[model samples]
Target: MASPKLTWNIALAGECMAARPFSVHDDEESMRVINLLRGADLTYAHLEMNLAHSRELEYPNRGDWLGSFMMADPAVARDLKWAGIDIMSVAHNHSLDFGPAGMLATKKHLQEAGVEAAGTGLDLEEAREPAYLETRHGRVALISTTSGNKPNEWASLGKGGYKGRPGINPLRASFNYVLTKEAAEQMKAIARELDVLRQADGSTMGTGLKDNEFSFQMPGDQSTRGSNVFTAGDHFEIQSRCHPRDLAGNLRSIDEAKKMADLVIVAHHYNIADGKRREKVPTFVREFAHAAIDAGADIYVAHGWHWTLGIEIYKGKPIIYGTGNFFAQSEFIRRVPYDSYESWGHDMDRLPTLNPADHPLHPGLDTHNEAWWTSALMGLEMKDGQFVSMTLHPVEMGRTAREGTITRQTGQGDHALTDGRPLLATGETAERALGRIQRLSKNFGTEVTIENGVGVIRF
Candidate 1:
């Protein structure tokens, strides 16, 4: 029989934080102490406070962060659809930034605008369920999960909530920890109690637990708890180690999704922001992406770091570490500078050279504001079962053909040219961007090449 034709175009993965405009004066230096505190608090308290203030001061009428991006240019959303993105994963840390109300509004807007969203819902059950698409090829399922960094308060399926409800996937959590005393004892007692109940029922009690019983019990003491005690010989404790690439929950979701679809795609918001050359890829990325491929995922995409990171191909499947910013067009927010010692600090200015005269898109005095805009746009390509190619479209925040167009360019592909002025990143700018990708990928044993201002990662 001839092979089935794949109906879906592609699945784009990346992070789009709750949109809250900050003033141009909100620079890294201005918020250094706050950011340091934010790092110390893990809750992103300082960042949240700043976002809350921005919402209150800059967007009083908007209600939440969703309004700013929603009311901005429609062109970015239009371009995303044009780029063949049929589905999106909103399970990142920022999904609930504007609270559940903002998340729900985002979901509603995307759905109304014709895009499918996963990883959040009105309640836990809804959030756990995958978004099904009936494509020409076959049924496609998209599932998403976060690092649980966002407040659960904003996580729901109803109006003003994220995509899915909140619930722990036992299978995913099993790989990372052992069972606790309370959980293990609880499961043992439950099993004994169930046995007593079964005896009382006298309904042909079998020697072993039925598959249905196993399925039901597996999530509780039997699976997560049982495995924890049996495997680790200790009580369960959440792992403190940071692993960006670990895909435990993602893989489990994919396993369940595979039973209901022709193919499974996993999207996540992972943080691997050291941006330096190293001998090995971060432990989390390696474990998760590799495990996902082993579990039969067709694609694995992650985004959290604000810039494009790198890509890796494991067992023929494409695992994109970070796609940078897909539709991030929010300006007026304070742009935090990466520490001066960091390599990322070099490209703060839109100009390629140290001097301003050589770069036209150079924001000059407003370098921090333009830097974020200049670093967006990195797309993926896949054909059949293999990832074929990748492209980077340089985007700028400015007026488009239409009044609110956040215009992007495929390396000078279109748009009228200015008066013989040197374009941004002609030489030095391209080198720095590509260099960052290369340096970051060094730990992963991956080779990335920048051809005509586009960084390409090959397996």
Candidate 2:
């Protein structure tokens, strides 16, 4: 069944970020991005930063090895709402940076600021449930999940006489590291030499679960570590897959969403990249996106790559694989906690004061990556829940060649607190960004027409 609403619009943006108040900036580029976002019946954005409700609420950095603490001021939530972000997916990797309290605080602030948040809660049940938004055109239901979470970050059910862990909705993925025969043999020889191949019980274990968690890499996805030699294949490759339970859980939520609301949208944050092949999409991500469409989701968005991927039209629905940063302001995060700094081997004494540009956590600021700098703000028009047409409004995040000239908006007197605004891509800037998306979409045989300096898709 399709949404009864006819000829309604939905704007899809990836990665919502803004530390300072963005509403203060009404520059041409800002207005261009804002107009499209506000004009949609449903506006979706992936929330990657925790609202620093209070730096004192901060827990010890949980993502030290793989990430850093990223926060925008709490008031930024209101700014985002005013700037037209109706719903946010709070199931990204950074959702737990400050712990459960921080995650809930972010959700509370979003709701208080008039925004709907999905994929995070005090229990696994709530986290997996759909969040709804009612509009004049139709009612929208969002089911958000993230594959980029750690063991401690997943919401778990409480046992007998206990409470469940408050966390983000998790869609755990597995990775199988394929090793060649020669490499496997070498590892086996080393394991035999070290006398660690067999347990005291004399049973050979193929893997362990600590360091390599391709399947959580949980200890033993890769057999190279610690005197453990496993079987090897003829060729080397990396295969990515998602857990069955998590997949079933999300698909059930999608079915629930379809029944609950007129439009069903599935937003998944899957940042796991294929090690052996960085360019191609992960096996499980594709499978999950298609499965979501099959389960009655009107739109399936898989993001958090920090780079744009391909787009696929599956069963007449849109499966947007990658949406680059909607707001590229990680570099503008006010404070880089001592934990994050120390993890990168930079203590307060070694590096007294940190400039955002000098920080290494945000590579997009220092690099010239096409997907990082330029992205599209996608607008889709649907009739009775059937896709009619789509428009890609090229967005130019600052500090890149793809962005337009900035009018220079700042937060207070602090340069670090400035708004991370996206300018409208013009001329060759728009052409190149759309061209990259076109080339990527071509991988799925989806042709994008470049008309009037924007990408258009009619189905």
Candidate 3:
């Protein structure tokens, strides 16, 4: 007799910055989205922002306000639970924005609201661990990690068993510029000077004064060719490799989850490219996703660019490059650090008077500007733990007017906190958004059928 056929539905969405204020009466659009989530046996979402109940800044703003150091209201966790999100990936660039306290607070609030979180913890090992959700249909496991993160945001293991440092799961990478022979020589001279000074102080890390192109050193290479920085020929190359320890740790976690759960989902946060354009994915991302599938991951979800990327099916597993933002309510965030304004050559007071459009670098008060505002929720149906069908439910993340009133308002515009929410796209909006997915996925040879404004994968 054939094995028992276990059937289940799973829904995965992009960044879920659900900063909107909770209300007793939710809008029709919000309810519609929530009902769709409820239809799935397991729903996974990316918790892009930390849930900080207070408006306090634990670390300096650092003047890097371009999608860094973000926090959200803790109350939003309750709303996420109400939305029927089963599990969330808590690892991202902003995971450690406010420090460990803030990160743990966000996790606590999410758990209290009945949502399981993964990709962050009290220490490195904990952060790399998987989060599991037991459903009537099957047990679902998720291992989450981020490719873009600050060094300080990386969790650490305490020496001598003291106490493990708190932080997020990090996938570190390196960059090297390729230049002509003449320019490479000049860089080597400078590197040598720096190396001499450092060696005088008993340092081992190469100053990059020793190698060029073919002679360039790899990170773990013990030979003298290794350099902290090096020069090559032609275009710049980014080492998209995951930190060795992190890669090993995550692979182990995936193996563990595979044994412990019936359905394994690996979620990653990586934005190596920019804008709403579907750029070539970094090599390391592809390697990691493929490795996860080989390690028994049934579904791979990657997000962070705030725009959708191409889709690939590897070994019968689905790898979604980028899912964009599911619920982008950044405009409604209650507070901003002082340095965020200082970086713009202005103070906090100037923010109120200046429109986001006028700011040199800002997500803008309008959330629906680019493809960042357009995204889709992936719905998968599995039979006997085998992929059967997948659908893309295109959604518009914005606000609507109340009757004939103007769509724009002071703080509550089309993308305000209370107003900002994900709504199913219909009519032309649906046509355009779903059509974009078609074009983005075309390169991967994935064809999708648009029916009733929803895109279905040919599978």
Best by TM-score: 2
Candidate 2's TM-score: 0.87
Residues forming the 10-long window of minimal summed lDDT in candidate 1: 41-50
Candidate 2: which stretches are off by over 4 Å?
Answer: 1-5, 195-231, 348-361, 402-419
* Tens digits of per-residue lDDT for model 1, 252-363: 5678787777767766554332233222334455566677778877777666554566667677777767655423433322332122112323464542333312222212
How close is each model in CA RMSD to the real structure? Answer: 16.1, 4.4, 5.4
lDDT of 3: 0.73
TM-score of 1: 0.52
lDDT per residue for candidate 3 within 281-375, as digits (tens), equals: 77778888998898888888898878787888777778888888887666556566655565656655766775442333345433334466667
Question: Which scores greater on TM-score, model 1 or model 2?
Answer: 2
Q: Sorted on TM-score, highest at the top, how do the candidates line up?
A: 2, 3, 1
TM-score for every candidate vs. truth? 0.52, 0.87, 0.83
RMSD of 3: 5.4
